[model samples]
Target: MDRSANLVSFEKIRKAAALIKGAVLETPCLPAPRLSQLTGADVFVKYENMQVTGAFKERGALVKLDSLGDDEKKRGVIAVSAGNHAQGVAYHAGRLGIPATIVMPVLTPFVKISATRGYGAEVVLAGNTLAEAKAEADRLAEENNLVWVHPYDDVHVIHGQGTVAMEMLAAQPDLDVLVVPIGGGGLIAGMVTAAKAINPNVEVIGVETTLYPGMWGAFYGKEVRCEGATIAEGIAVRDIGEITTEVVKKAVDDVLLVSESSIERAINAYLTLQRTIAEGAGAAGLAALLTDPDRFAGKRVGLVLCGGNIDPRLLSKIVVRELARDGKLVSIRIDTPDRPGTLGEIATVIGDMQGNVVDVEHHRLFLNVPAKGATLDVSFEAFDRPHGERIVAALRDRGFVVRYLEIGDRMD
Candidate 1:
């Protein structure tokens, strides 16, 4: 299937590049040495997160808005999105003097809701899911005579997203593969169309969270269940777009599914190793690489860091969780006599071992603990796994009953 002929064409994408040239940033595509070392692939990251709205959605949003007729623009536009697309349309529409209305799920993060409103778009919190939100957007669009600017599934939007690939190829024409995240499939579809047209030899792979394999399920003709509270909420789509599914069927070489843990690790890697912030969906491409290094080893791989609008609190939790996974943070429980010196001895041992105590809890009411005995739950920061182990071993040598605590361990 020649998707370029029937769906979005290379020529149209080129025009979109010209139309949105100055409106959207041409984010840098730079080599990432640390990521390359970690993934065993010569990695280059297209920093789409560096855009003014901190995502690549602005490119497509501006193109779609610009294509509207004067009368249509006057009537304003309506769109349904989780967050990134909402901000994209809201920001660009405001700049173009076009009133925009965004319908977002009620459960959307407060940060995104506030950001969309800040961009001058009237935000309507509707539905528990994107599908439900779209229904409300459709009804509102018809009632108010507003122009419907789809987040994906439109030719202009697809063409606009293709500009990302055009820029990527222009920067590194010899890239062996392009790893992109998939939601409603607009980004990957456009990227596949442009990348394949520019360099047929370059493989284009799409990534989706395991919780929402909308594109993957569509491409493979399987009834994969799609529902979960994924940290990558930007890509947690249950339904793939009709236009995008067609493009994926014809052009996308493969689609990969990554787990929540892998996504968290990838986000942490971007912050600690690359010195950058990558939202959950943004880190999915790198998560694929981490999932299967051998597939891309020794090849020149390009990853689109598509968005960086993650909630600060979520990002902090992911960072701390990763630290605990790496043994840099640890929690331990010690059973000792309910005496003052018992706590002091444990603290002294931890301090003497160069561990920093983060928190401590005293439990005396536990039925299992003797009346004179108490349980001390201590959370501490350690240099590494070995260092933590040495501390635990030292505590044991002092005749204290010690137990290491895993994440999600319940006290009861």
Candidate 2:
């Protein structure tokens, strides 16, 4: 596919805005006061999380469904998504009285699959991965004579998703920087199109997980072969859309790849500090800001919080990981003589260091320790890394051999 400049004119985006006016909610643009303080940038979050389907996908899905003729609608629609798009298509199809069948990867979030099913769509669990699910969806569309509603490739869908930027700029035209999360390039493509049309001076940037830098490949002409697990799975497309790649190449200013840890931290921060539930992809724009605060410092920036459909179990895991990342949780292994009060002695040291022991496991028979020595793994939470280290050193100074299992960085 040619990565040339293919802009959806401002007129088309305006038409899309008109077409989707009463159908989609005009989500709020919230002030990010805490984030602004952290990054030295006046940050405002475009809260698409509160959209009817809990994602910006509703905008594009509704537009695409409305534009379809009666024949198309009667034929029903087939869509493949890991999560957000499936819900969007299913929800709008139900509202429009059109039959829809959605194909989802088996690995998709439980919340997303359940939401899509609740929207009155026949759900098909196709494959373990999204790419395979998409192949199955394409085959089903052909076999069942269903109209395919692509998540991000079509021109109509591009126009539909651009409405986010339209409403965003309308709410705050002075936004100097726009940070968007990329999946298959649809959302950011639409955003850049509308944003550049309104204010060409605005810096339109894209954010992706380092594990799945699809947009990075489309922009920088890389091989486009990132494949791994990411918290922001909603934006983890391996392939870039043809139209979207062109629009992005012409209009997008920069594409930054962020770490999974950054995404997890952003999700936790939004949940705890902002009192918002943003899914991995939804928190991605904020992750970019946190990754390189210096780039956006003092600028009035706009971010698209793309979606909010996450499984409860996954959310719990993210919270736990975030705590560990922030040094609040530490797990350590200690070798001690199998004598009385050995465990009590370690507990006393941890308490003295102001660390609260959360859990402990002792290994006697499993280890190769002598009859007099045993292995103990203790987990605790502390105020920070320094406090946790103090507890470790205190135990060492007291003639105990201790090693912190969680002290090493994953970077190694």
Candidate 3:
């Protein structure tokens, strides 16, 4: 496993850039003023999420597909991906008249599975994790004589992914740091290869979800437990590619692991502060900055927003959760007499304080609550934490026992 020998060179990445030119978008790399303010860094974002398939995967998939011989193209290609890579291969293969089949994990979101199928690839749902799905893809490829289009391991794929950094540095050559998210390591490996080649002084940092610190563990030689449900499911990889590991070990400046909560906050920041949608993995770079702002403060940092194909329902939940965390949405419990006017009185106090009640639940049969009294659980919208606190104070002034409910607290 002499990975140095297999390292994707700058020349190959240049070729990939040439091959993908006109076929794929050279997405914008622009200064993010609000993000800069938040992180205390001169933040520039590469909008890879603006690609036709809503991810940077299109770059690598197209380059890989173009490298296939005519006979191989006719034989079709098979790939295993949670979502983004599947759509990339499926969409490009459709354009090239190459039949495509995608094997996806059973837990992949319905939105992604549907999008992949919509791209004209025959979709097969198999296995519970990506590793399991890859096994099924291997079997299918063997039986059907399909060419395997690996999601990240191949040299061609790595070279194509490198174009992201090439373009980023071309647009802003003075970037002090380039923060990239790692799944199987193709993206960062490629980016680091190009970034370091272009300007060795520019540090390339890799970010991974704490739950799946595959690249982090490989870089540090630590046995990390890489299993969990993370919002950044795209990078929830348990294994690192051999070539990527070698490149990261040799070239990458640092590998950082970010918590799931930080990832969620980054996603929200992208939406609220930058007016863009960033999926969990796409926001990992920003999460790294949020997790440790001082490290990047006052430096020119480039962050790759790699993908934006988040499920609508999940995005809505993230938005609501952020509002709750900011105290714009508040939940409270009140113990009061079960009399007819009790509920109206409480509602009046909230209304008088300009709090907009959204949901209310009444429980009278609880063993803890007296038989003649009931508990009112109310969720409301306020302008800010101070406003919510004011509303709570108003309730208490009226002699109602009110308790603010924290997020994830069990009402029981």
Task: Please give the range of 10 consecutive residues that has the lowest summed lDDT in model 2.
Answer: 403-412
Query: lDDT score, residue 260, model 2?
Result: 89
Candidate 2, TM-score vs. the true structure?
0.93
lDDT of 3 by residue, 1-412 (tens): 5555355899999999999999999999999999999999999999999998899998999999999999999999999999999999999999999999999999998888999999999999998889999889999999999998888888899999999999999999999999999999999989999998999999999999989998999899888888988888789888778888888898999999999989999999999999999999999999999999999999999999999999989998999899999999999889998889998888898898899999898998879989888998999999999999999998999999999887556557
Write model 1 residue lDDT over 183-293, tens digit each, in one string. Answer: 998998899999999999999999999999988988898889988799999998988788888998888999999999999999999999999999999999999999999
**Alpha carbon lDDT at 393, candidate 1:** 98
What would the per-residue lDDT of candidate 2 be over residues 1-412, giving only the tens digit for each residue? 4533354666877999998887888999988898788667899999999987899998888888988999999999999899899999999899999999999988888889888999999999998777889889989999999998999997778888998998899999899999999999889888888998899899999999998887798789887667887788899888778888888887799999989888988899888878889999999999998999999989999989899888888898888777777788998888889989999999998998789999888877763666778888888998987888888888899998887676332211
Per-candidate TM equals 0.97, 0.93, 0.97
Q: Residue 77 of candidate 2: its Cα lDDT?
A: 97
Q: What is the lDDT of residue 301 in candidate 3?
A: 99
- Model 3 scores worst on lDDT over the 10 consecutive residues at 1-10
